[model samples]
Target: MVSKAMHRIDQQVPVLPIGDGVARSARQQQRSPYLYTDDEIQRILHAALLYPSPKASWRPVTLFTMLVLAYCAGLRGGEVARLMLGDVDLREQTLEIRETKFFKNRRLPLAPGVMTSLKHYLVVREQAGAPTNPESPLFWSPQRNCGYTVGGIRLILTDVLRRADIKPARGAVGPRVHDLRHTMVGHRMRDWYKAGINPQSKLPYLATYLGHKDIRSTLVYLNITPGLLQDACERFRKNGAAAPQTRESLP
Candidate 1:
């Protein structure tokens, strides 16, 4: 009998990519690393404005107003829900943001459109038989016979997001109600840069606008690099050249 030659069978092994970067990138996509982009934000706002609430006998008008106020005021959902008729100063074009987080309250200016939209809302609110007291909440559901709570506001946003197909991932994860507040601050910083405002110098103002007790909280929202980085680079280039040796010289 001839001895059979021993042969090795090749084992099936999966081919793996050489670099781990691809896997890392795939993991990162699973994470939300950035706020909504401008276009995405606009879509979000539009969807919010179009949200159909059972109590929206005015045809979702309150949803539109809420989105505008949330965007323009940088106000959190709690603050938005808590807003009262007298809190707004129509003549001064300012809103008195009261009893915010950290025991802080502040006054914030309003854009013309925000003021106008609110006035229009007030008209409809009166037509809908809203309470006559300025001390009462500005937002109340005729159907619910109560003011809109933070949960109510969140529900409206959640509904809108679902309708727009922009809802966050399930399992109690993803974007939050406060994200809109952060988004507004980010948008404000973007506009400030576009208008050539000194971001550092005006940080306090932003904090005040958002009713932040400290400037640091406000800075968290304006976390993007475009304005701050660009300003720093431009300032560096200018000072790199000879103008005044002493500090405190800028036009």
Candidate 2:
């Protein structure tokens, strides 16, 4: 714009063409998400539970519970970090995720097992002298006396992943904290297939549960895996044979 104005003011001024000869940079390929198996998830959780820290007694349990919520509830790391005490309702078995990505708010029903785990964590959190006020962070950092930051959550999870032998000690290539969300989606779809349910029909519900603006956004997480493929293939085989077939005469 400055160049254009200068050229307008002075006929002698040359407005060199911008981006005329420049080649557009190639779009970087997005890394394939690592879909975690049930055993791998258990290992990661176990590593978190055993994470040793002398100053913060609540660290181990806090990390464990956070991972559980991330994987089981398909929560984004920020959503997990931003949870307030009042957001969780043990009696109702629900979690109220406040303003998140795209400035959206959502409430999610917790599975019974997840609720039980959370209840156990709450007991531990209270024992550790965490503030019980409704506004206080659910996953409090005793050292900081505040909620864990999104970056902090990722770093901690990375360390746990290393301990669990799920990732290299020093590298960017590994199962990320965000992969838990993908894993949750993949696992849920696989389960639906095994149960003889139509996963396509359930996509919108999953999208809403994950706080996605639309099913298209949710579709990115549904990477085909061996187990999911097997179940899907089985479903197709059984249903394909029974599907009504019509004969059409050729012109």
The number of the candidate with the highest lDDT is 2
Q: Score each candidate by Cα lDDT.
A: 0.71, 0.89
For residues 173-230, could you state the per-residue lDDT of candidate 1 as single tens digits? 5555556777776766666665667667888877777777789777667666565567
Poorest 10 consecutive residues of model 1 by lDDT?
1-10
Task: In candidate 2, list every pair of residues with a backbone clash.
Answer: none
Model 2: residues with Cα > 4 Å off, grouped in runs? 1-29, 244-251
Cα TM-score per model: 0.73, 0.85
Using TM-score as the measure, the top candidate is 2
Q: How much does each candidate deviate from the true structure in C-alpha RMSD?
A: 11.1, 6.4
**lDDT, candidate 2, 135-209, per-residue tens:** 999998767877889899889888999999999999677788889999999999998998899999999999999
Global lDDT of model 1 = 0.71
Residue 114: error of model 2 in Å? 0.5
